[model samples]
Target: MSKKILITDDALFMRVTLKNILVANGYEVVGEATNGQEAVDKYDAHQPDLVLMDITMPIMDGITATRTIKGKHPAANVVMCTAMGQKNMVIEAIQAGAKDFIVKPFQPERVLESIKKLIG
Candidate 1:
């Protein structure tokens, strides 16, 4: 079976871009969240194999959500999405229990690579 994924980003365009890439690659996108709090809720609801989370979001930030999810579910797999100049936040995301990261203006290969490496 194809692995399930949850995509969380404040920008609708980003989420759509990620969904397009993932779906084309045969990864099943189970849910989408517009903010960190929603991401956490969706994570609990879906129990997806992986999460692609954006770092700077309203309501809550991705790093904090990753920390919350990992705190409750140590095995939860999270991959942070960061833009240029968000290097420090990416590091923070990793420390907070993200499995890996993908930089925005993402390459489809990188997204697939991280998900495959983490879950497959």
Candidate 2:
């Protein structure tokens, strides 16, 4: 079966772009969130196999969201979305239990590769 994934990003464009990438590659886009809090809610609601989360958002940030999800479901797989030069935040997210991360201006290949590596 195709892996189920949740996508979380504040930008509608980014979400749409990622949804297209994941769907075209055969991964199920189980849900989408515009912020970290929503991501957490959707995570619980959908129980997706993996999450693609943005680092910066209006509500809770991705690192906090990652931590929240991981705290509840220790096995939850979260992939943080980072902007260029946010190395420190990326490290924090990793410490919070994120599986991996994709830099913004996302490359479709890398996104799929990260998800595949984490869930497959």
lDDT against the true structure, per candidate, is: 0.94, 0.94
**TM-score per candidate:** 0.98, 0.97
lDDT by residue for model 2 (1-120), tens: 998999999999999999999989899999999999999999999999999999999889999999999999999999999999999999999999998999989999999899889988
Model 1, 52-96: lDDT tens digits are: 999999999999999999988999999999998998898899999
Question: What is the TM-score of candidate 1?
Answer: 0.98
- State the weakest 10-residue window (summed lDDT) of model 1: 84-93
Question: lDDT score, residue 32, model 2?
Answer: 90
Clashing pairs in 1: none
Per-model RMSD to reference? 0.6, 0.7
